[model samples]
Target: MLIYLSIISIASILCLWSEKSYKKGELFLSGFSTFLSVMVLSVFSGLRNLSVGIDITTYGKNIFETVSTFGPSVAIDYYSRWADTGYVLFNYIVSFFTGNIHIFLGVSTFVVELSFLLFFKRYRAVLDPTLSFFIFNVVTLAYSFSILRQILSMAIIIWVYYLLTKGKYLSAILLAVGSVLIHKSAVFIILIIFTCYIITKFKEKINQRYLLLLMILFTLLSTIILTRYPETIDNLIDDLNISSIQLNNFGSPMRFILFLFPVLLIKILIKEKFIQNNEEYFLYLISLITMSFGWLGGINYSLTRLTYFIIPIYILFISKKLKIINKKSINLIIIFWFFFIFWWLIGRGSEGGVIPYIPFWKEYIVF
Candidate 1:
């Protein structure tokens, strides 16, 4: 915890010092910095810390049963192949290297890094050319961009975007077909892509006015419906029988801060043409809508995790149009991340909880 605080302090200082360049391609150093911090902290989340709920996800424990199923479900703990496929595939490939642990990390790292690299490359053309490879692509992906199940899907989706923008329609379609096979969430994404393509095919402009207005209404309605009837939505999504994510535990009220981000972002980023010209804005808007849908889907339902599916769009939106440090946004940023400068010492991250501004009201009075 002390180390994490020190890291945050250093990053805050860095954030203060750097204004012109925040790293490159379409990502920010802050994003990568946060990821590095999480990686280090997660080392402690082993058997002793997050020792419960079975997230280790190894082949040694249940490869046979994992293969028995179609790997269709997320329940790898009960012998689902979804988690074990990567593990099983890695075991054979790593027989040439050291132990399974090294192999696991190695392949995991490669698959993730390759996936994100492809994604950054796809958007590089329309993004801030100033960001090129370092801040936008490298730092962001290096951080924590691909640390989950659906990341491969993100990579492929961006490639689909690239092909679409570059006029490689056939290739884009092929990429979408490939992506859905990797993760079922890709299916929902494919639908969004096709819908956008159809809408934009002959449209004279990006048409932000109507899209923006409708999105605002949709967001409000979704938030109200979900908060009011969390149970009903929970039952709806959970009928597939996957374990429900603990929303109450993440102190989800903190996520309301997410809504604040694009708003705060637009405060400084509004004038930038990046929001209108770039194909990515469309993707970002729809993804944000999807995130709102995820929120409305249920409580304690992995909205944070669901947000991961849209993170690239978020980062791109920031780097392209919102990376600048204005007086207002800067002040708000401190408030945004820290809430109070002493939050770690007395509030959210103050206790041993590494998750910042989360678990909502679960206060831990650290001495």
Candidate 2:
């Protein structure tokens, strides 16, 4: 726990330095600081023992061993049966170099961190990069340690979103397909993005207030309907042929409230005219709609994972809002995040067992 906290403290200071350097027009210093910030967390995450994350020990390790053992020739059939093609292929490719699971995990962590670094770079103008990076570290990075494949998929979807904003439609579509190939869960995210995109086009035709209300109503209705008639969820999962995810687990209202908090902050920012352009507003709408899926957590906690893909954009939106909001409100928001981070990392059973922070090399000796 102390190691994790220390990493966060170090990252926070580095990000602040990056922001200060950027303000002073010191591009090289700013970029180097950002790189150092990413490396700090990445190195720590990469060096962790396989015992650090539940999935890494079981499914993650098992899959890597299977692929590396059978060699790349088995990838096609193996992936077709039980695993995501891209992720399995990744394991196969990594097998060519080294059979060490630690090395594979380190590479995976670096890739995930690189994706986030690119995301932060793309949105630097719209947000305080310091806050964006910090929020990601606090809110999402730990989860990546456990759910490697899904987080990698989410990272690809972040690129998809970035491309879409740049009007690179074909490229975005191709990358979205690749993202789904990495994790089937990405299908839900793609659907959400398409729905949001369509709505964004018609947003001017409809009143913003009513559209917001409609989204809220949709969230409420969906949650109530799914919970009351769970068969609806089961049947849909059957039809979709996606039985990999078990929606049986449920989450508390506090989790839902945490997801909702940012939406409310975005709403406040909207009223304050902080949404100066269409792209920012579009991301705001996507953030709200994505978070609305959090309400469905009552039905199946797995349903909430859909919100993960939206997190990068959500962080950027919230950071921008925080930048523009009053200092008192900012302090309150920071306090809330600190409390939430403790609750999530500590109160939530160490969040995939990332508490002890044992380096892989020292695992046997320390234990």
User: Best by lDDT, which number?
Assistant: 2
| Residue runs of model 1 more than 4 Å from their true location after superposition | 1-54, 58-61, 64-99, 121-148, 216-253, 272-274, 278-281, 290-294, 297-300, 323-367
Among these predictions, the greatest TM-score belongs to 2
Per-model TM against the reference: 0.58, 0.84
Segments in model 2 whose C-alpha atoms lie over 4 Å from true places: 22-28, 73-83, 228-252, 265-270, 274-277, 326-332, 338-342, 349-351, 361-367
lDDT scores in order: 0.44, 0.69
Q: Write the per-residue lDDT of candidate 1 for residues 193-279, one digit (tens) a residue.
A: 677656655566665676667666866875776678656444422232323333332233444443445445554445554355436
Model 2 TM-score? 0.84
Q: Candidate 2: worst 10 consecutive residues by lDDT?
A: 240-249
lDDT of 2 by residue, 1-367 (tens): 5566668669768878987998899989988987787778777876888887656864467778888888644654654524378888888888788888877887777678767876776666756666676667677766677677788898898888778777898999999999988877788888777666666655664456755786789788887887688676554332322233222222445556776776575566557575666666667777767667655644554564566678777777777776666465664676467457545534453544566667887866432
What value does the lDDT take at residue 215 in candidate 1?
66
